[model samples]
Target: MADARSTAAYLCGKLYATLWALGVLGTAAPTPSPLTPGRDESTARFPRDELKRRLAAAGAHMITAKGRGGDRAQAASEVFRSIPDLIPVAGLPQKRYTNQEVLQFSQGCAAQLTTYREKYGSLLH
Candidate 1:
C-alpha cells in the first residue's frame, strides 16, 4: 500500500532524516500518523488534484520548517524527483497490500533514496 500522497510523505520523512544525519537540519514535532481504526491512509489512492496538494504540503514542510538554515528546497526537489509526477485523472492503480508486502515496498523505496550529496543511497541504483 503506497499511494502518491503516502509515498510522497514517506520520501519527505526519509529526506528529513538524511538531513538530520548530515547535521544540517533541526527537527520539529512528529507528524500525526495517518493510521487509525477503520482507516489506513497508506493504502488510500487519492485523485490527481488531491495528490498534487499533498505533494505541495510535503514540499512546504521540507522547505519552510526549521532546518538549521540549510537550503532544504533542493533536497526536497531531489527526493521528490524519485517518484512519478502526479498528474492525470486516470491516476495510479491501487493495491491492498499485506503488512509484509508493505514493509518490503518501503525497504525497497529506502534503498533507492536520494540524498543531497548522492544520486542514490544504494549503489545498485
Candidate 2:
C-alpha cells in the first residue's frame, strides 16, 4: 500500500499473476506456474521489448478506464501510481531500469512472492 515499500518487479509480478490467473499469459486455462516455470523464457525474465509495449498499452487502458469510472483498490491503482505518478505512461519510450528495478522483478518472478499471492490472490480473482 505504501509507495516506499513497493517496487516495479513486485507490481509486475502481480500483473503477471493476474494475467496468468485470467489465462492471458500462456494457455487459455489458468494453470500453475507462469509460462510453465522452467520451460519458457518469460518464466524467468519477461521479454524486455514486449513487456514495455504491453505495459504501456495496459497503462494507457488504465488511464482511459479510470477516467471513465473511478477506481477501487482491487484494480491495483498503485501499479499505475507507481509509474511514479509523474512519468506519463504513454511516453515510456527510452525508459531504462536501474539495477534495483531488475532485482525486484526477478524476486517477484521467482521468489519472495508466496506471501503476496496468499494475501492478494483473492482480490485479484
Candidate 3:
C-alpha cells in the first residue's frame, strides 16, 4: 500500500512537471489581475491551480483506496481517466489549437503514458 501511494505521488509529480514544461501550467510568477487594474497579487491563484487541486485530490483517492485494501490499480486508472479534464479552456476564445501544437501535445501525452507504464506496469495489476 505504501508502495502504491509512493508510486501515485511519483506519477503525479512527473505529470505536473510535464504540464509545466508544456506551458499547460501557468507561469512561475503571478500575473496582475485585470480586475485589480495594476495591483499584482503575488499570491493569486492561476487557472492551472484548479487542475493541480484536482490532481492532488485524485492522488489522495489513490492513497485512500490502497489504505482501505481496495484495488489500487483501479483507483490509479480512475485518476488517469480524470487527467483530460485538467486541460484548461477558460481563457481561450475558441476551442481550437494549431496543428503543430496539437501534435506536440499528443506526443507528450503518449510519452508520459509510456513512462507511467514503465514505472508501474507490475503494480497496476
* Cα RMSD, each candidate: 9.0, 7.7, 16.4
> Candidate 1 residues 88-120, lDDT tens each?
233432444455444433443343333333642
Cα lDDT for residue 80, candidate 3: 53
Q: What's the candidate order when arranged by decreasing lDDT?
A: 2, 1, 3
Candidate 2 stretches with Cα past 4 Å from truth are 1-35, 42-46, 61-74, 83-106, 111-116
Against the reference, the lDDT scores of all candidates come to: 0.38, 0.44, 0.38
Model 3 C-alpha lDDT per residue in residues 1-125, reported as the tens digit of each score: 33322232233333443332222112224323121324412111222343355455654545544454434445355545546543433421132334433333334444565554465453332
Q: Which candidate is the best by TM-score?
A: 2
lDDT of 2 by residue, 50-82 (tens): 445545565544554354443323344543443
Task: Quote the positional error of residue 87 for candidate 1 in Å.
Answer: 9.8
Clashes of each: 0, 1, 0
> Among all windows of ten consecutive residues in candidate 1, which has the lowest summed lDDT?
18-27
Kindly give the stretch of ten consecutive residues in candidate 2 with the minimal lDDT sum: 19-28
